[model samples]
Target chain A: MARLGRVLLLLTTCLGLLGTAGCGDDYDGLVIGVVLPMTGPQATYGEESWNGLQLAEADLRQAGTNIKFKLVLKDEKSTPQEAQTQAKTLMELEGAHVLLGSVASSNTKTIAGAAKENGTPCITPASTNDNLTTGNPWLSRICYKDSVQGGVLATFALSNGWKRAAVCVDNESDYSRGFADNFKGAFEAAGGTTHFEYFKAGNADYSNVIQGVADANPDVIFISGYYEDGGPMIKQAKARWEGKPVIGGDGLDSAEFLTLIGDAQNPIYFSTHFAPDAPDEPAVKAFAERYRERFGKEPGAMAALGYDVLFVLMDAAKRCANPKSAAELNTAIGATKNVKGITGLISLDNPDRTPNKPLVIVKVEGGAKKFHSTIKP
Target chain B: MLADVLLDGLGLGAIYAFIALGYTMVYGIIKLINFAHGEFFMVGAFVGYFALRDLGVDEVDLPQPLPILLAFLVAITLAATAAALLAVLTERLAYRPVRRAGRIAALLTAVGVSFFLQNLAVQVWGAGARAYPEPGIWLYVDDLPAKADADYKIRERVEAVVLKGDAIDTARKAALRAEGIERVYRTPDLTKEGKQGFVLLALLLWTPVLWWLVKRTRMGRAMRAVSEDADAARLMGININLIVAATFFLGAFVAGVGGVAYCATYGSVKPLTGWIPGLKAFIAAVIGGIGSIPGAIVGGLLLGVAEFAIPALLEQLGWADAKAFQDALAYVFLIIVLLVKPTGLLGKPQREKV
Candidate 1:
């Protein structure tokens, strides 16, 4: 009986070691970990992004490649600290070599640090904060940076002959601060004066800020904030400043924003990655139609960016050798070429893996988003 | 700016006061902080939403005010009744076993009950924000012109120029068009006359009804007795459980009305919509002298005013750059009130007989 118990204990110890050893295995299939805010205040956005990633994965599976892609999803709960923990767990426990993540810029910052330390390639779908890819070599994003968006809006204002602008920014969010700083720089450089007002996120009332902007009497108002506060701000601003044009960044590309404002005549414009209507690219059209069919609603730019991130990973995986290790997979992802995506042609320009993608400008007209134009990098 | 802020604050404060009544009343009797009170408020909101939206109550329009009044009455009653049943069931199933337990156990049980209800609500309603369809009567209230100049100018202009011009134009163009002279100058009044009328009617009718119930009724006397000393009241031929249930019903009824009032005013409702108001109302109750009814009213109103006024005052004082500090204004007010008058402005301090 004692000898039988010793044999059983030995067997259990061997199984545990085998399980731990599986982490370093050279697997035939490619497993990518996706960290997102699957549940919380931003759950809707996270779920939509996940849906887009699934659609892209399906497309990859049908292509009949030797590489079978596996996705390990982790919920970040929309917090930077949680994102960092999830990133570490995904890398250490889940054995994910490549990562697609994180809706918010703050989350992206932490996950980027994790990916860098682990020597894994992390791609962001919708984090537009400029600092994400500014100096990070391991981090790449499918979305346009806030600086590009800010420059695009500034150019639009300049070409339209708007001489003065006022800016309202959310001080807590990195996305808002980055966009505000870049827009201010570009607008002032283009000979336009700007009056700036800063407010905290999660605040619903914007009457005082709106009043301040109206008092300044600028030609246009640029609001750098997410859709939650952006919607109320635009609505209240319309009530106070009748016909003034309100411009914002990619955060305004949400149906919720229009629903909150309850109007299409607010002359609100935003810079986004893709538009539902543009040059009739079959890839873009198919993505939009498939997304609408699946989700029972039109997909936004964030969803498109998520779809593109998966394809970018797939293309990189196809270039790599079979039974690839983490280092080989990371190398392949770093050498990604010009791949056409819903967001435009994606190509990693720098060895640091910063993607050069197109940014499109759109306006809310008649309660629908109408495509204006696209700016190429 | 100050006037607008104050008016907004007052409207918001009224809502807080209504919700605070439930917390203070329950705590007054049981000495247990019912953390699930917020979930009750949430359930009430969903009830109102489902009634108006899914139950087709908002779609049916009758000739007189009877249909509107009936729909509102039914919805409010259903919500209030459900909330009362839930409170009682929670007490029986979760709290009864732990009734004589330590204060910490009761508090933890309250938290557990809160989580259970929130999760249950999410499962039933789905994990997304649900829209509360505004009743037809309340749909266009905010669109109403608040200023006399705007209202009178539009009305006079329509009557003098547009109506007369349209009549003349239609008469002249009748031969060209085969249709009769159709006046295209019809414009409904944009003022909030309907809402003001409803509020006045409610205040006139419900105030007297509530006053009669609380001041002149036998159940009211029993409720007051239970609130003062439940054990003594039980010993004095009063059924303590029945009195407690009645109190819950009354409190939840007020909360049901508050739910409808919130939806009517805000025009939107989310799953967690009750959270902000629930927290603020709890704070209001604490500020108003926790067990004092009138104090809850004053506390709620004061909290609302402070929410708006503190930020404005700070901004005016050139501290607008620190807008994040605005969210902490309520806590600051609560701390000051606690320091100045521990039992609240109108609350009587209790003496320990031991």
Candidate 2:
């Protein structure tokens, strides 16, 4: 019996070795790990971005690129812990050369950490929190940071002569707090007074906070929260503070927000990554048309950014001497400059690996998103 | 401004009261902390959503004010019945099996049921917030000179204006027409006072019914007897099972009503809708002395008012940023109440028979 057990253990060890070797086999292509919230609360954003990624992949193949690409998609389930686990699995198990994805900033932070630990290049299509890319070199995002949008809105508010602003910040969310802080700083610096009201995310009632804002009686109400809370808050606020131009960050970029407010005549404005209607650029128009045809739904900022993330990754890969090597891809991605993206001109030459891009300010008019203006950062 | 804050707080208080009543009553009778109680509130909200939006409650054509009033009544009845049935079902299947096992076992089972229902809701309805259809009611046109062109639209708009309790002059109507708006109706909108008024009215109507049920009815006496001592009450020829189910029915009924009020006030519902408010209501029950009926009401109102009012009061005191600690303040209130009155304000001291 002992002799048979030893033989069986030896056989199992040999099988494990062969499996490991097979996984480590080299492929002459870029293996991009795509982690996204294919389920859970942020599924809409994930599904749209995933569609965009697929379209980009097909387009790249049709356009005929020198470097071969292999994409592996994993569901992060709209959570930070899940995102981290999936990113690690994609890198260690699937032999991915680079990582992409995770729409939410909190989830992207975990992916960024995983990428840094594994010495792999990671880029996000949507996560806009400034701190995610501030110190991480391995991490790069196609979308502009929160500070840019905040500053742009503040400047825009100032230009509009909206002096007094009520900045409603969701204290539970890092994105909301950071965005509100940045806006408050920029707005106050330019001699505009801001009244701050705080709320937690996932709250159904904002009556107290709305009453506070109404009492403050600000010219513009800047909601620094996700659309889930922002929509209801704006609806409640409009009941009291009528005609107040409620401005928000890209967190309010969801079709559900328009539906939530339901055709109210409160001139709502939010700064987002892309506006398909404005500027009428041929590339953007074509991308929008293709997206509508493919998904049979209007493409939002996430879809546009997701489409750009791949092209930017490919652009960097084509420049690299060894496109499959993680280190080479990382270096090449950091050296990206002036790549024409559907959102805007993308560049990642900065040490922080953040691209300087223009943000589109869209307004909720007639229960639809209308392009108000674009702010160059 | 203070009135606005109070009214909003009262509106919130009504919701808390509905949920807290469930917790208090269940704990009062069974000594099982029904953690799944909140999920019933959530289920009721979803039921209300479906009833109003998909079930054709809004499609019933009636006279002015009759449609919306009928809609509210039908929706409330549907929600209450659904919640009551669910409560009874959970008790029969989950809680009853674990009843004699111990308090901890039953409590854990309650929690298990909560997770099950919440996940089930997610599966049934995707984990996204669905917009609650606006509940608007029309009123009779008091005295506006009706326009010949689009007279029905003008009357509808005038009815809406009248329901808002605002006398719109000819110039205002002309401005509205020029803006290309045809029909308007009264909703939680068109008022400085929030949805609290409607919620408060519901509470005022329901609390007395609840009071009469618990205090004045024959079943109320039997429930009180069973709560006092289930074995002794059973020996005395009271149907212990029937009383227990009735208690659950009453508690869940109010929770259902609260759900309707919640959606009507908040304008949206999701799978996880009941969790937070349920937690808050649980805290309210604890503060009010969990097993006491009056305790639940007082506790809920106090908690809700304090939650909204304290932040406003702090802002008045120039602590403009105190809203960040709004949720924290609720826990602190709970802790302080527990510390000062260990048995709660209205709870009787427990006596062990030697």
**For model 2, which pairs clash?**
none
Q: Which stretches of candidate 1 lie over 4 Å from their true place?
A: A1-28, A116-119, A134-136, A196-207, A210-217, A236-238, A322-324, B54-97, B113-216, B322-324, B350-354
Docking class of 2: incorrect
Q: In lDDT terms, how accurate is model 1?
A: 0.71
On a 0 to 100 scale, what is the lDDT of residue B18 in model 2?
88
True interface contacts reproduced, per candidate? 0.08, 0.37
Tens digit of per-residue lDDT, candidate 1, span B36-154 = 77777777877877776556453344543454666677776777667667777666666656757867898898887776676566546643443344333322222222222221112
RMSD of each: 8.3, 7.3
Across residues A43-161, which tens digit of lDDT does each residue of candidate 1 receive?
66788789889888887778766777688888887779999998998888878878899999899899999998988888898888777776777788777777888888898877778
Interface RMSD of each: 11.2, 9.6
TM-score of model 1's chain A: 0.90
TM-score of chain A of 2: 0.91
TM-score of chain A of each: 0.90, 0.91
